[model samples]
Target: MQNVSSQQHFILNGFAELGDLRPVLFVPFLLMFIVALLANSLLVYVVVSQRSLHQPMSILIAGMACVDLCLPVFFVPNMLLSFLFDWKGISLIGCLVQMHFIHFFGAFQSTFLVWMALDRYFAICTPLHYQELMALQRFLKFIVPLVVRNMLLISLFVSLAGKLSFCRNVMNHCFCEHMALVELACGSTAINNLVGLLTVFLIPVFDFLFIAASYILIISTMLRSSSTSVKALHTCITHAMVITVSLAVALIALLSYRIKNELPAAVRVFFSTMYLLFPSCFNPIIYGVRTTEIRQHMLTTLTHWKRLADPEALDQDGLSVLRSGKSSAKALHTCFTHIIVMVISLTFVLTAFLSYRMNSLPNAGRLFVSIMYMFLPSCINPIIYGVRTTEIRQSILKVLFTYW
Candidate 1:
């Protein structure tokens, strides 16, 4: 074993255990990365380009989309390199950098979610104050502190990890995970562990509690109003779903980390990867499909594209056939398609979560579950949104046929 202190680079032993199966995994992983990248980028573009989307909620969504856009870039490319060419060596400084951004973005994501919850709380619980409270300038001012706080904390964590003398140069899982790197150190990691705990567990716990409290208040407020209750609850559904999925995956990842000895190496790796990847890929889909304003803007953009491609396709009001009206049967068909996609996505996610608890399950089955859990949501989300959302579907078809 080469001493990591003397070694210039650490070897990332990513999926080396899979051997020939690495290539098979590469394509899907690559596809997921691309889809997540495009989805998030498109979301940011839609929010930023449209002047009407400059509200508090849209600003927050755009901020999150930016974070999600950068989050995957830190790890996925390196993972792809490992899978395709078996290139797993990352420089020690590079490893530290990756650890920094990974944690930074992860923390930023939690911050964004908390703020989103607060945004909803204000919007629902106190509508009049929301405008004054969540103004763009004020929101940015609030976010700057949290952003700085995350940077400082993560920097300290990384600095503590970097100062450690490493006995070995190989990290067991993919990318440079903080604890994974800490575990490789030869020196006493008590401080590193403490700081890691503070950054990982304590900070996230605070965030989770804050988000929960916000929603509790939101729900209470909604219950008090019989007239606007249904509409208010509808507004919260997308934010609630994003929060649920993000925290659920984070909880499972934390569990996998805690019980690393009980689960197979691959299972642990997949859980951690899913935690990193899922929220970024899924959040945009939730907001895009569920949020009325953003969806309307996207539809408008697509309608413009349709207009350029074929003026005859749109009716007098510039509404395409798909947007003009949906038949009852068509509505049912779209609803069923959404339900099926939701069921499939949930099944894979649940299987991955359950696989860690079930020691009796075969390693290969767990591995397959993990792969599907990570891969399907990112790819499936865009397809569902693009296909089942009638306006988007028609616009896409118009563009495709025009180009063809």
Candidate 2:
């Protein structure tokens, strides 16, 4: 292989070995990206818009959501292009920038998790001083410094990788991974190796230790007090779930990278990609489902939509008449519409599955099945819902006429 200049583009060998599975993989990746973007955006909006959620923990969660919102954009677009068009060439600068942001967000999240743990520690261990200790202004002061520190450290780390002379131009993974790029360098990478170890491994380990200590103290305090223990433990559950998810993905990625030679190329890539994808996609979902205030807020918002659609159907306590087993025409219409959409969706999905499983199936039939699987449900869903769902039709009309 010839040596590539820094000015040249590095080719990403993204899932090329998967052959026909590439197009099939595109749908889930696209769905995950959309879900991550929308979910994090919604979480941030909820925290910012609702006055009841203006607490320290809520603000930290919103901060994490903001980071999650940006994290997927760094790699998902390239992954989509790779899956669909097989366009995987990225310039050296572009690769470095992507590497920097990926690591930056990862580090930021790890550090922010520690901050959240600290918030919980203060809230539980020092209830009387919690408000004063985690004041908005004071919290911003702490967070701003950490943000700058991450930017500077990650910039230096990427710069060190950038300084190396490349002996190869092909990356065996989807995105621009740090050590993968460093491994392509021609000369000694002793400095890069050391800094990479520090930035990638030790820093996160330290953050994890701090978080563990904070939680230990929190649990000790909770154990000592019987009255507030349940309430305090409830409040910590969401953050605990978030930490577990983030650390689990990080551990998988770390082990995959460490044992890259033992693992298949696909397994390594999948684990690394999951590190970047899973937390952002699931953290807000965990919060939404587990946190009482946010869950109640979401329920309230859905109930408000129902009230807007059929005010008279809801009693004084906001319970819908449909819940009383009195089936209405509208309820029947919704059930039928849902059944039709489910049947159509499942039919296409099953056809797609059979095409992949049947060895005798032709490539043309497989391709057609893939296309139908991808397009049919998406194209029909909105039309079906708008036509059958009164709420959707009214919402569309209100938006159009209000804007007009």
lDDT of 1 by residue, 155-186 (tens): 99899888778778888788998888877778
C-alpha RMSD of candidate 2: 13.2
Model 2, 1-404: lDDT tens digits are 32454435798885655777777778878988998998788788788889999988888889888988999999999999888888889999999999988988878777878888888888888889999989877777767866787787788879998888887888888898887787778878888877766665555677777777777788678767755655555555545655665676576665555443444555457667877887787777655534657655655555667778986776754365233332332443355457546744775676568656644235665576579778877765665565334466456545644564
Alpha-carbon error at 61 in model 1, in Å?
0.6
Model 2 CA lDDT for position 333: 39
For model 2, the superposed segments whose C-alpha errors exceed 4 Å read 1-7, 235-238, 258-261, 302-404
TM-score, structure 1 vs. true: 0.78
lDDT of 1: 0.73
The deviation in Å at residue 132 for candidate 2 is 0.6
